[model samples]
Target chain A: DAGITQSPRYKITETGRQVTLMCHQTWSHSYMFWYRQDLGHGLRLIYYSAAADITDKGEVPDGYVVSRSKTENFPLTLESATRSQTSVYFCASSPGTGAGPQHFGDGTRLSIL
Target chain B: QQQVKQSPQSLIVQKGGISIINCAYENTAFDYFPWYQQFPGKGPALLIAIRPDVSEKKEGRFTISFNKSAKQFSLHIMDSQPGDSATYFCAARTNDMRFGAGTRLTVKP
Candidate 1:
């Protein structure tokens, strides 16, 4: 497809297990972002990458790791999943940092048991 | 402090009625404001957007009204319909973009 896509649409993992959510975009955008959505919290940014090998922390980056080895891929990994981390994770991409509308992936629903 | 604040956690309106959602921001540096609509099990899609330079922008049935001095903006849906039911998020961007808590709107028959 021509748009962004996320893998493992639905996942269930143990609390201490490691889990990674993959996000890929065909647009070759310069910016990619990872956000977690929970009830009452809307969407909180976890991490974002400005370009290849350039990433920065967002509002809630703890326990989450993101890497952008390629401009088309930015993957988020949880070193040790926790019950609190059970939420719908979304991946988005933008052409650049300023005044651009972000294109979002369908989202990954992760449940930590 | 919460940079962006949205009101009316939830809203319900009958078909043909108007639906309004409001948001306020504390950051004066925010120059761009956008609203996104999300259906169940789907990611949010940009609905309409506006800049502080203009007081109002309308596209189809959606309109964004901005008040720079007040640090507030609102979304007004003209002639709401059942198909319009969804969660709407108001967001602001300057150097960074931040989304509000979101408002769930349900349009009934």
Candidate 2:
């Protein structure tokens, strides 16, 4: 496919374990975002990157880490996974911050026990 | 704090009826509004969008009503169908895009 894709569509890990979810896009977008969708709370941004090596914290960044070493890849890491972190994680990319609608991946369903 | 507020967490509309989802934002800087639709096991995709410059925009059976003064926007689906059953999210874009809590819409056939 030509759009964005997330690895390990479904993941399960224990609390305190280190887990990384991978996201890759073929569009070479300048902006990439990571968000977690939970019941009642909707979707909340976790982290985002403006460009390669330019990542920043989002609304809920605690317990999560992200790095954008390449324009096409942005990976999110849970340094110490917690049960509270169990949610559907979505990765999206936009041509730029002020550009058009963002394109989202299939999303990674992560379960922490 | 929630930047955008959506009403009626869940909605059920009879087929061929109108389905409306409303949202309000607190930020005046937000200029762009978009609605997303998501099905089970699928990612949300842009359904429709509107800019502050326009009061309304329609694409086929979907329409977006924007009120810049009230900082409110809404999505209206005409002639709703079973295919329209999905989660809808409204988002506003300022320096960043903030999404609403989302509405689970069911179009009963």
In candidate 1, list every pair of residues with a backbone clash: none
Model 2 ranges with Cα > 4 A deviation: A99-101
Instruction: Compose the digit string of candidate 2's lDDT tens values, residues A3-34.
Output: 99999999999999999999999998899999
Clashing pairs in 2: none
lDDT of 2 by residue, B11-43 (tens): 999999999999998888887888999999988
| CA lDDT for candidate 1 | 0.92
lDDT of each: 0.92, 0.91
* Interface RMSD of each candidate, angstroms, one decimal: 1.3, 1.6
Error of 2 at B40 (Å): 0.6
- Per-residue error for B11 in candidate 2, Å, reads 1.1
DockQ of each: 0.67, 0.65
